[model samples]
Target: MSFTLERAQAAEPKILANGMKSFDHFRKLAGIPKLDEFFVDAGELEQLLPGLPLSGDSALDKLSMLADNDYRTYAVGLTRWNTSGGLERKREVEYPPASNKIGYFNGLALVEIWVIDPPVVKASCGHTVVNPLHLALSYSDDKRIFDERVSLELGNMLEELGYEFENRWS
Candidate 1:
């Protein structure tokens, strides 16, 4: 389905309300030290949630399995760009040549779960410290396949815990 920011924003509150406690449970299981580190390994998720139903390399396949079991899924596609040259340059070359792929995922995958009372704090020095309650999964260079696996496993766990699951690409 085509993703709309308005729809996503409207859905956020419900997702957060339903998934907050469960999200915290998974975060503790993953041993995440910070909030922004939303992604976890499939192995870790499996270890934490032994009864999850989906597995393997393909995100689509896993998502299909979840749908069969009556879970809602959404996919969002994301593109990363080099913005070191500032806003004007960013607009000028939105999609740079392939040579500039370093430090960027031309098509990165992200799975986000909403949460309430995100653990974010602003320090006296004015720096924001984020300890998010939401969940997001992404593929890293070293473990390219794990992102899909983790996202699927997370969905299974959330369902088991009595929350609706939505998968987004962005």
Candidate 2:
């Protein structure tokens, strides 16, 4: 489907609202030291996540596989950190888990399409980290990339996977 700027303007609030955790939270969980493929310290990362991927080229290989094939990057949700929102408090006490799979960097695919061994939950959801590397801040208001590429895809994929989307905007 063709995504338009108006649609993006309308959807921005909802996209930002979907279950955002901190970069530190998912970073520890995913065992990914950094977002871009080039910056990962393999040796240290391996020490951290013993069993999972992230050895040598395996992590990038897996990233390409997940992104190109099954919307794998979507699994590790990348979101804009709402500075005003602050840290996310633990809310599972009230609602059922937002995503069916609540994973902590195990490398197992969290998508419902794949029934992982023992039925593992969601692997990772990308979050907004206010950092120099976050290019979203650079986007001109009229040309916000959130409407076009990764964010839209990730948001839609989450909805499809039964993620209970929350509109913190309202």
Candidate 3:
């Protein structure tokens, strides 16, 4: 189905609900005994709820808006960095640069959805680099186990939404 603002708005509630459920599944699969300790200050199940509405004309905008709305500190700057594997890396990036010989679309937002306990799945907004908008999900850990578990959880959530999603790992 075509992605429209109205459609997005309609899907928001279910999407958020599933997103949180996906997180819980991730925690269980990851063998995280305590959700409170695993998910920063928020207690188990509390952190996932009442996700803020992300505002923007584009899907990336909405995602970023939702991320920002959920975490105020991260939104002050257009980009933020988090430590992963002992190195600090920018959490967001522009999709296409002018130097590329192949035509690639821009205005896409590549966001890393951060959770205290890392999930296995990597989420992306578009099918390819040429796609205009994207929201890619990555975790702090680089373990294959995490990636696999997260991918499964994410796949299940997307499936519940009836959204076409690709599992890059398989």
Which candidate has the highest TM-score of all?
A: 2
lDDT of 2 by residue, 1-170 (tens): 22122333334232224354232222122232122111222243234322332211122223222243121211111132122222222221111223445442233321111111111122233322112111121222222232333333333433443332242111
Q: Write model 3 residue lDDT over 1-170, tens digit each, in one string.
A: 12132333334232233233333233223332111111122221123322212211122222222221132211101121132221222232222222434322222222223232221222264211111111122222232133454444434434444432332243
TM-score of 3: 0.22
lDDT of 1 at 75: 19
Query: Which scores higher on TM-score, 1 or 2?
Result: 2
Pairs in clash, predicted candidate 1: 35-132, 74-167, 76-169
Q: Rank the candidates by lDDT, best first.
A: 1, 3, 2
Worst 10 residues of 2 by lDDT: 111-120
- Structural similarity to truth (TM-score) of each candidate: 0.21, 0.23, 0.22
For model 2, how many clashes?
8
Candidate 2 regions exceeding 4 Å error are 1-38, 52-147, 161-170
Candidate 2 global TM-score: 0.23
